[model samples]
Target: MSQVPMITLNNGVQIPQVGFGTFKVDAAVTQQAVENALEAGYRHIDTAAVYGNEEGVGAALRAVNLPRDEVFVTTKLRNGEQGRDLVQRAFEESLGKLGLDRVDLYLIHWPAPALGTYTEAWAELESIHRQGGARAIGVSNFLPHHLETLVEGAEVTPAVNQIELHPSFQQPATQAASREHGLAVEAYAPIGQAKDLDLETVTGIAREHDVTPAQVILRWHLQQGTVVIPKSVTPERIVANIDLFGFELDEEQVAAITALDSEERMFPHPDEGNFTMLD
Candidate 1:
């Protein structure tokens, strides 16, 4: 059912490279937004406990009534829920909210290096994988050093590293580290929070391809082998986000977009802000 390309994780779990993201999607509208996404042919849905909308994602899954195997659902453990024991409990809570027996992918939303508990939490994630509670386990917002530390201390190498990535703020070092460690780089804010949509390089390419700048940016991500999860509640935008399989970007077009990387991250760095989950 998915015409979108699938990126096989290190563990052999195939994830749709272009998934629907629900970062700030309000809980009240998350279900409908997710429904719009599913109806528009999105087979992957990324959410988190901090987002407070797993229930909506779950509802959309049930409403869409696609074969469970056909959809790859990813949710993260909240920053507040990072203890060895707490992570397990958090995973259960997320599963309950999503109404799933097992998730396709479960990630620690942040490394939370200040807490000094990520390694312990990773241990529990490994145990969960062993027990079939999660098909894959990963970390989000981790930088290169954090990735090095986590991989050094943990048994299960993360299957994916979800991070802030867009044309203007691509973290090349982090991407290199993730690839070096065998983790798939999953890009959140794939469209640069609308900041990169109007850049001359992106727009020029978009005009050449007869697509939106958002589409151009997304196409750039896909061509470079990163998984992109772009969020949108608007029905037209939702449909347009996943409409990426029809065209291919040639070498020069891809390079021009790649040249836009400024290392300017649009979101909080892994070690910078409050480690606590959002309200």
Candidate 2:
């Protein structure tokens, strides 16, 4: 088993640098997938209310029989539940599904600024953090401009900003802003969803490292000090993804991968045309 590294948040809490993400994972198969990830040594699990698999994830944690404190579970506040008053209900519902008294981290799934609700949501997150319902709080898919507005209106600085980051779309501006604000940067699609494997640069690195393209990509994220969550349902791939700490990418290799950034995003904007999942 590979040893995963840990990063310290702005509030001085430690979180795993690499985690297992359950984004599109079906609820019916989520329990077994999570169990496999746990067995493969993933201490962190990233989920969301929108994913509709918290109950499955919770079942895995329970089935693993690991001490509750041994694993770090994170769930997000979905768009529909984005106000101060509604957030309390949302958090409780997530907790109930996870069967945990408190989640390790809770995130504002997205900043639906057009609706003008994230400001209220941030306050509710701060309240949740203070009340110990969530050990840490963060935002997802937030750009620098969005973060700035959030900071201006937020009472607590978000501890982490989860975004679509990979070799092809590095988001340097977001990374710089996160570093400047003491918010940890988390890469949601560090392997480019395996879409960039055929890229010459990525293939070249994988050959040099004697590893798979996905491992090379993940190593790049780790070298940049960005937390990465790469999802895979296959057990062999899950094991292979976690086997990254054994090797190190040199400066030249890191730069080679970093140079591939085109600032493009693979996922569609959750904030386009004032449309939202809630609607």
Candidate 3:
């Protein structure tokens, strides 16, 4: 097993810098996919209620028999499920589905400002944290303004901000805002969904390191102190995604990849619609 590096969040919870993502993974295969990832030395598994695979993730955990603390599990509230009346119930449903008493991290999947209940959702998350139901609470797909609004009434600071960050679409402003509030930045599409693998800069760096472009890109994120969850159902790819610690990217190579940022966000703007990151 590769010695994956850990990022200590503001609340003192440590998460693997490299994690196996289950965003688009099918429920029918989600169990086996998570099983294969666990066998491949992945200690972190990211799934959401919207992903509809928390049961499969739990099944895989039962099958693997690894200690609960060995794996870091994260889930999110559905886009339409954010409010004082609904948020707590939704979180309990996620926990019941995952077969766990608590989750390592729970996030409000979206701000859905139009719904105007994210601050209320944060209150419930804070309550969950106080009750020891969620080790950490955070938000996803939140912009700077959303963060500002959330913190105004939040008694607890979010530990993380999961966003659609990738090599091709680095939202530097959002990252700056998240850091300003002491939240750890997490990247969902860290590889740009493989659209960045064929880039000249990425390929050159991959060739220099004798690794795949995916590994190089993930390593770049790691070197920059960002948590990345690259998803794959294929066993080989799952294994390859976490095998990143063996090699490292130097400053020049990391810079070349960072220069590829074009603000070309592949996902919808956070404020535009109630996107659940379903794609």
- TM per candidate: 0.97, 0.96, 0.97
Query: What is the per-residue lDDT of model 3 for residues 17-97, given as tens digits with 9 covering 90 to 100?
Result: 888899989999999999999999999999999888999999999999999989999999887777688888898999999
Looking at model 1, report the run of 10 residues with the lowest lDDT sum.
270-279
Q: Per-residue lDDT tens digits of candidate 2, residues 1-279?
A: 337888999888888998999998999999999999999999999999989999999999999989887788889988878967799999999999999999989998887778788888899899999999999999988888888988987778999999999989888988899889889999997888888777898898888879999998998888889998899999999988889976888998889888898957797675663335552
Per-candidate alpha-carbon RMSD to the true structure: 1.2, 1.4, 1.6
Off by over 4 Å in 1: 277-279
Over 4 Å off, model 3: 275-279
Q: Residue 215 lDDT in model 3?
A: 95
- Writing each residue's lDDT as its tens digit, candidate 1 over 1-279 gives 357888999999899999999999999999999999988999999999889899999999999899998899999988777876687888889999999999999998887777887788889999999999989999898889988888998878999999999988889999999999999999999998999988999888888889899998998999899999999999999999888877888999988888888967677777875476532
Cα lDDT for residue 204, model 2? 88
Q: Give the distance in Å from residue 163's predicted Cα in candidate 1 to where it truly belongs.
A: 0.5
Candidate lDDT scores, in order, read: 0.89, 0.88, 0.91
